[model samples]
Target: AGTVNPLLLFDEIDKLAYDVHGDPAAAMLEVLDSAQNNSFTDHFLELPYDLSQCLLMTTANDADRIPGPLRDRMELIEVPSYLFDEKMEIARRHLLPRQMEKNGLKRTNLRVDDRCLMRLIEGYTREAGVRQLERVLGSVCRKAACEVVEGRQRVQLSLARITEWLGPVKYRQEPAAAEERIGAVTGLAWTPVGGETLEIEVSAMPGKGHLQLTGQLGDVMQESARAALTYVRAHAAALGVEPDCFDKIDVHIHVPEGAVPKDGPSAGIAMMTALASALSGVPVRAGLAMTGEITLRGHVLPIGGLREKLLAAVRAGITTVLLPGKNRDSLHDVPQQVLDALRITFVNEARDVLEHALAQSPVQDGGAVLPDGEAGHAAVCH
Candidate 1:
């Protein structure tokens, strides 16, 4: 009791139980609050000592787990997780080289190249901090030491070798669906770890133009799609489409890999484009990728991960990429090789995107020159 004791330490206070029976933690508020503590009445122990004399401290692993009402009473401090570069720095400057010498193995006896380190971070470990990364590298060092003790003079591990030793890559891009259809767009999303390419698919059936969604999309994303559809319908006349196209078709939008939930309005533009292409008998320019949210006004708002998305598009063999005009500042960060190989189009409107994302008929061999908009459906945007 705060009235009887002078100090209190609450470990795992975040996990305290709460219900009609009683929340002991909530009952302890008066004793814990310094301002009102001196006037607190303790029914448990009939002592009248000042509760403010007690020093109270609480600890928790994840702050989110703490009840909001309780969390508000405490001062919160956050410790951010580390990145790969920070892990590499820690390993190179301290971890690996230290472990090698401690295990009595010379630097010449074993070496892990930068690529190998990257593999260890990307494939063997999934962590925001290097605690696990340090442990895995320790295991690798132990194995390398055993090899040196025998007859092996030197060893170097590559990305593939890391997988062989670690049993399999912990992370790999989910394979895009084998069948690339007219209404699907592969979008890259940036997370705290890195970029993940998300496959957004839109399918339509002969019914009223109702929007149906699946794949655990969040409210923001669902709203983004709604806004996107509204924008497309409003601009139907200008895009050379019928106003009743959506009214006549029942459309379903899905982001594959339902196990992982996704949110954010950034994918709105991409979703709109895919659905527009599907309903209008047009194909999204093969290899052309886009991101951004659209409103009823048809403005393409910028999204994050410009460089990472462009890189993902390039890896997917996409040559012509469409990006929000506001993200032009990020263009400088893209590799020259990607820039040279791909045609990058930046636009502020959905119409600008539509103009470039459609397949233009390619000039047939030894035939008449094709017109600007006559490009036949070639999925190869590159």
Candidate 2:
């Protein structure tokens, strides 16, 4: 251990603790520092130890929980959650064989179709990782093992058999194929579990220019709604809305699934699109999804979790995705099959979002209008 370099892995570094006694994170800072670790001394050893040659690797679900100085010392590589197809491949190639062996079931005795595996993924498990999926497969294998012992020679698992083995479905997917309407737009969200679809709904009614927000939104999301409304008001003339529309109307922005608390700046463009659609009396295009932060000046800003968000969009039957121009570089992370199945457009401004999301052209003074091509341009498609 003297001169030979050793690799050390610290798993779940976010769970590191601190108390009145001492801060472990602070101690880790010194160990991780290349400049100081060369002569680092252990309290118990009372002797200097050279840690400069040591390679340190850490894993954490949320990097934000790690101390800023310690986090700054390491290069962050984000590993996104697996997509549906990737999960299926992993299950088929790895989990099914492993679980079958553990349950004492011969490979020839049981068969699970690909469609059935997909059903299990969509209905029984809702997580970012495959741990839940492995457990569910283990459960199915255990049941099949029992059936074999009870004199059933061959067992075939299908979608219908999932409920019999795993009880009622635990998760319900809101129909993505439902009809599209005005004042509602789909936004992609990234959570600790994975990417999810967020539906933002906006409605205007007669009032004294009040903006009401609901659905347990956090501060940043509320601010996003405000920025979106402000942008719309500033561009009312261009959008073909009455200049004083808000003076006699109240605007309400609501995200569905109200029980789950929602926050983040990434929903800005979605909220803006919803407001624009509602105010302009145009319906949002069906099967279209988007995610991006928006500035008061209507410029779109990049957000995180592009790959995960695009996967969520695809799962929800979305055929087109609008992304910020800055995020175009990350398109390589998405699978080529997914990219081929969808129309991905990159935009630098809110006007670009409007052009793709609106079902009909914006109306001004009772006549249809087009966005100024000179104002901004679209990024090349992926």
Worst 10 residues of 2 by lDDT: 373-382
Please count the clashing residue pairs in each candidate, in the order shown. Answer: 4, 0
For each candidate in turn, the TM-score is 0.63, 0.87
| Local lDDT at 26 for model 2 | 81
Runs of candidate 1 with Cα error greater than 4 angstroms are: 1-95, 99-104, 125-135, 146-161, 174-181, 304-321, 327-344, 360-382
* Cα lDDT, all candidates: 0.69, 0.85
Q: Write the per-residue lDDT of candidate 2 for residues 1-382, one digit (tens) a residue.
A: 4554999789988898888988888878889999999988887789998889888899988888888998999999887788788899999999999999999999987899998998889999999889999999999999999999999989999777888889888877665646668789999998878889998998887778899999999999999999999998898767667666668788899998899999999999999989877777667888888999999999999999888788788788888899999999989888887898889999888888887788866544433354541121111000
lDDT of 1 by residue, 263-349 (tens): 888898788877766655566655566777787877888887566566566545666667789988977766676688778788787
Q: TM-score: which candidate is best? A: 2
